[model samples]
Target: MSLRDRLTEDLKLAMKARDQLRMDVIRMIKAAVLNKEVEVKKDLDDAEMSRIMTTMIKQRKESVEQYEKGNRVELAAKERQEISIIEAYLPRALSQDQLAEIVDSVVRETQAASLKEMGTVMKAVMAKLAGAPVDGKLVSDLVRARLQ
Candidate 1:
């Protein structure tokens, strides 16, 4: 099923199950997707949807850290819960080993010889990993370590 259809189905189930957190998160995702369509004037494919969800997860993760730093445990936990719910609909994440292997291959493919060529390696890696859920930051760290 398409990501949009899956989201709709999950939204209905969340409503039936009376899961407020899930309901809210799904609604937010739908709204974000709709807004993007309106803004871009086109329907989003699964890859675009995955990228949006990844951005949402990244935002929530940052929020969780900020809340924790402020000693707002409850708020941080809520952010974490939202992240889990959002991630459920995203593509499967790559393990560190898998990510490292991909990064190594990308570096070789791009012939990235040093840290200065990090962006070249990153672009190639992102292209390779497109539609797959991998954190950009983790990829950057791995590439940097390897290149350095």
Candidate 2:
């Protein structure tokens, strides 16, 4: 089944099971997609939807960090829960080793011998991993270390 279909089904299950948190997250996702579709005047494909969910997860992670810094442990915990729910809809994240290997290969392919070429290498690496969920920060660090 497609991701949209899965979300619909899960939303139904959440409603039936009285899973308020799951219900809230799924509705938030639908709303985000709907808003984007309205803005772009087109329906988003699965890949686009995946990107939206990934962005949502990234935002939640940043919120968690801020909440922790403010000593709002409860809010941070809630954001973490939301993050876990959102992640369930995305592709599995690449392992650190897997991402490092990809970065290394891209570096070799592009002959990015120095930090000056880091931008080119980063673009190539992100393109290579386009369909899979990855942390941009991690990718940057890997490329930086590899170039160094």
TM-scores of the candidates are 0.95, 0.96
lDDT of 2 by residue, 19-112 (tens): 9999999999999999999999998888889889999999999999999999999999999999999999998899999999999999989988
TM match of model 1 to true structure: 0.95
Residue 102, candidate 2: Cα error in Å is: 0.6
How many clashing residue pairs are found in candidate 2? 0
- Local error of candidate 2 at 6, Å? 0.6
Root-mean-square deviation of each candidate, in angstroms? Answer: 1.1, 1.0
Q: What is the per-residue lDDT of model 1 for residues 1-94, given as tens digits with 9 covering 90 to 100? A: 9989999999999999999999999999999989999999999999998888889999999999999999999999999999999898987888
lDDT of each: 0.91, 0.94
Name every residue pair that clashes in candidate 2. none
Q: Candidate 2, which ten residues in sequence have the lowest lDDT sum?
A: 128-137
